[model samples]
Structures are given as structure tokens and as C-alpha cells.
Target: MTASSSGALPQPRRFLRLLNFRDSLWLLAPIATLYGIFALIPFALIVRFAFADGGTHFATVLESRILVRVATNTVVISLMTTVVALVLGYILAAGLWRAGPKMQRVMLAFVMLPFWTAVLIKNFAWAALLQDNGLANTILQGLGLTNGPVTLLHNRLAVIIGMVHYVLPYAVFPIYSAMQAIDRKVERAARSLGAGTPSVIWFVILPLTLPGVYSAALLVFVVSVGFFITPVILGSPADMMIANLVNYYVRELVDFNAGAALALMILGAVVPLIVLQQSMGRGGRHGAH
Candidate 1:
């Protein structure tokens, strides 16, 4: 009838409560196991391959020049594509943001239409348009833009164009959403305070949407580093990305260790960039605070 009567039921009751809490772990155990099996295990294996020798021993994996060149090419193409997509997508998103709802809907549909088409179809379409004697050059020649067929496909430019097209939606959607989230009243208030149109945008809208631009740029950059199919169809050997090189190692050379090393290299480069970006963002936020 003392304190035990009200609060403490019994030792068995406490044991049952403990058991209930411990039972919750069972719910997560399966998912954890699956993640370990599918994700962690494969990653561990790839890392091991990266350190192991591709030819004879585990130590030879880091001694490949092809891996070095491929890694460099991947970085260059990814940066170029990210810059192009970010600029074009930012402009388009801005235009869409400024448009009326009807025009916005139409523009959005147009932007999204390409995504609905299959990637292979898009690649072939680019091939048809950009091939030396294809539609684009024919039109150019017809219009006296050039005297001969322009070399468009099987070049770095073609690779960049394809990557931009593939990554545009990724770049635009985030920035557009960020822009849409900005308070119109902030802009109106700035205008009311005698801020010019450009000033209001530069000072208010741009700053507000910077986070989204950063996010979209990183997303596009990461994806571009791994681009393969579009570049293979539209680009020459010089434009080969890390993913394509990795594919060649795995399939053509039948060197799984080298492929894994290349894959790990790509991951290594991207992870640092991401961390740098996040660090900069946090520092900015802290400074602002």
C-alpha cells in the first residue's frame, strides 16, 4: 500500500515493458540486414577492388593511366555541363517564374515533354539532328550558314549538349520551386521602398533562390559525372566520362577491379565537392546568424 501500489506495478510488468521496447528492434533488423546485404556489402567489395591489383595483385589497381585520364575527363565534362545547365535553367526558371499561370503551364509542359520521351529516342534524335549530313547541317547549308556539313556529333560539344539536355530538368525544377516559394510581398515591399526592378530582384529574389541554385547545380554535377549513354552516342573517345570508362573496363576489358577503382574514384571526387558545398552553406548561414 506504500509507493509500490500506485506507480510500480510489479517486476514482471516492468520486464514486459522492457521486452516491448526491445521488440521494436526486430522491426528494423530486416531492413538493416537488407541494406547491409545490398548496399554496404557491395560498397565494401568495390573498395576492396579499388585497393587490389586489377592484373596480378591487389596493389596494382592504382597504377592505371586510363583511370587517371577518365577521372579527369569525367570532372571536366561534369563541370562544363553543370555550368551550362545552371545558366540556361536559371534563365528559363526565371522566365517561367515571371510568366502568367497559363504561360507557366505551357512552358512547364514543354520542359517536361522531353523527359517523357525515352533516353534512347532522345539520343537517336540528337544523332539525326547533329550528324554531319543530318537535319541541322542541312538546314544550315540551306540557309547559307555554312558551305559544308558541320561536324557536330562525335565531339565534345555534342557530349555537352546531350548532358545539358539530360540534366536540365534536374537543374530547373529545384530553382523554380525555390523561386516560387519566395514571398511576393517581400518584392512588393522592396518596390514600395523605392527599390528598382533589377535591384529588387538582385537583392531579394536572387538571394532567396541561391540555396536552390546551389542544390540544383550539385545534383546536375553529380549526375553528369556518371553520364554514359548520351556521351557514347554523341561523343568521341575524348568525351568519354568516368562511367563510360568504367563500363569499358568491366565489359570490354573484363577487369572488374579496375572498374571498381574507377567507380570509387568518381565517388571520391563527388563526395568531397558535396562536403565543400555543404560546408560553405553552413558557414554562410552562421555568418548571417
Candidate 2:
């Protein structure tokens, strides 16, 4: 129909159309812009740097030994942290679950209290505790456990401890949330059917909570892989993570190319794990149906 032949649209209708379009754009704009600026741009930069040779290219930052060792350390540390956090968090979550609601809330608050403090502060606290003259060594010496001040700071142990402290809360909350979602009657029915505590846990509770455990493990691992401050504060040269290398390249060496490459490598490593998690989720959904 010709524009003139059609009845004139009401002002409210025209305004509503404009408002709807504006609202749609508004909904999308922040996410789109943020993805491009924060995620996409950095990722593109890192990919470009990864392939570029570090030396002679002046712009290139990828080095064979540096990349290999840093990547290895990063992966190892991340995996270790994930395992430790998952185990510890699971135990804590179990204990909390067993406790009454008031006690559970208290324990949960205690767990979450560390998160409210700054990460830097937490790392520094670790350093203080692990230092040669720190509490650990003093207690050891006081108990005649060692000859002298044990050098605990700036090592893999220190790094792992710091990371566990940082990521344990993340691990705890997800698993706890999953546990809370579980219906009490399900477990009660299993117990009522003569299933022992171990049987009920193994056959009922664990399977249902596998999704949360997997997700928590994945998230904690991913976060640990990109750890910078904890490693720098508590780790030695040998304990240097990929993220530390990235920061050194970007900040200390002022080599964006190498930094980008390292950062991209971090992203590349995490992407597969994320995909695997998603695939598992899809498979689980399909199986449920």
C-alpha cells in the first residue's frame, strides 16, 4: 500500500516502535561493545603475537623455552589448584551441609569472609605466614620440627597455597549451591531403603552434584591458569606462571607482541576446556531426555 493510502500511524505507535528498537539496541550494546573491547580485541592481539617470533621481529614476543616452561607451569599449577580446591571445598561443603543451618551459615560466612578482602592483601598474608621467620616456621621451630627457619616463601608450595586460598571460595560456593538445590527427601528415601551413608552418597548425592563439581573445577582451573599476583608474590623463578610471563612481557619488557601471544595462549588453552564442559552439559541434557 502507498504511504499516503495507509491511515496515518498514531504518534504513540511510532514512538513505541522507536522505543522498542532503542531498547533492543540498549540491551545489546553494552555486551557487544564489552566483548569487542575487552575480550575480542585482546584475543586478536594475543593470536597475532603467538605466531610472531620474539626476537629479530622486534614486535614478536613468542619464545620457545619461555612459552614452553611458562605454559607448562601454568597448566600444572592450575590443575593442582583445581584439584586441591575441589577436594577441600567439597569437604568443607559436606561439613557445612551436615551442620545445622545456623552453623552452616556461620561456616559459609567464614569461607566467604576471605573473598571480601583484597587479593593483594590475601597474597601478602600468605607471604607473611610462609616467610622464613613467619608463623609456620616459628611453630615448626617451637615444636622442634626443624633446625632453623624454613624457607617457605617463593616456591611451588607457596604458590599452590596462595592459589587454593584464592579459588577455594569459588569452588565451595558452586558445589554448596548445587548441594542445596538437591531435595532432602531423595537422600532420605535412599536411607530409608537401607542404603548406608556411603551408598547413598555414592549412588545418589555424588552423581547429582557431579555437574557442580565439574563446573567448579573448570572455573577454578581457568582462573588459576591466569593467576598473576599470587604467583608473583609467592612463587619463585621456577614457579612463574604463564600469566606472570605475560605481565613481564607487557609491563617489564614493554613487548606487546609477546605479551599478546602469551595471553592468547592462555585463552587458547581455556577455550578447549570450556568447550569440553559445554559438550558435557549438552550430553547430560540429552541423556536426561
What lDDT tens digits, residue by residue, belong to model 1 across residues 127-195?
999998999999999999999998999999888888888889888987897788777888999999999
The clash tally of candidate 2 reads 2
Instruction: Indicate the residue-level lDDT of 252 in model 2.
Output: 90
Per-residue CA lDDT of model 2 for 252-287, tens digit only, reads: 988777676656656776899878765754454224
Task: List residue ranges in candidate 1 displaced over 4 A.
Answer: 1-41, 51-61, 274-289
Clashes of each: 3, 2
Best by TM-score: 2
The lDDT per prediction is 0.82, 0.81
